[model samples]
Target: MKRLSVEICVCTKCVMNGAMDIIEAVEGLKKLKTQLRLNSQVDIVTRSFCSGADVCPLVCVNGERMEHSNSETVMAKIISLTSKDVK
Candidate 1:
């Protein structure tokens, strides 16, 4: 399996939109790492502002954007992005 790296952009606007939870959602991806037995590294950054501020709480898995409003969707996106067979 290819090593996975995840990047999350959390802006102030996103914070107002509940970006903290989104951050947690990305952290949650760690569970999948252990379960999938895949060597993966996830990095989540909370920036004051992102160019995608309009899409605050934006999640990018290996440079792909995953849009959503909740943790479940975030997790699903992460899984799809990192999974060897999915992307």
Candidate 2:
């Protein structure tokens, strides 16, 4: 299976801006990946700080930065990335 990295910023401002919610949602996605039968494995990581504080809720998927990110957008990105390699 392919591996994907997902990083979430947990800085003070980010946490206040709903980082926890995003984390939970992403975790749910990881748990459901097997059921979804995707060809990718998700690795969720937390960063203490991210330069994009102005855009509090930040997410990075496979080293690609995403600002103003929410659970929906993040999940969509993951699905899209995995689907690309599906056969």
RMSD of 2: 1.5
Q: Each model's number of backbone clashes?
A: 0, 0
Off by over 4 Å in 1: 1-3, 85-87
**C-alpha lDDT values of all predictions:** 0.63, 0.85
Best by TM-score: 2
TM-score of 2: 0.89
Please provide, for model 2 over 5-64, each residue's C-alpha lDDT reduced to its tens digit, 9 standing for 90 to 100: 999999988898888898898789878877766788888899875764598798899999
Per-residue CA lDDT of candidate 1, range 43-73, in tens?
Answer: 6655553575467666666667655455767
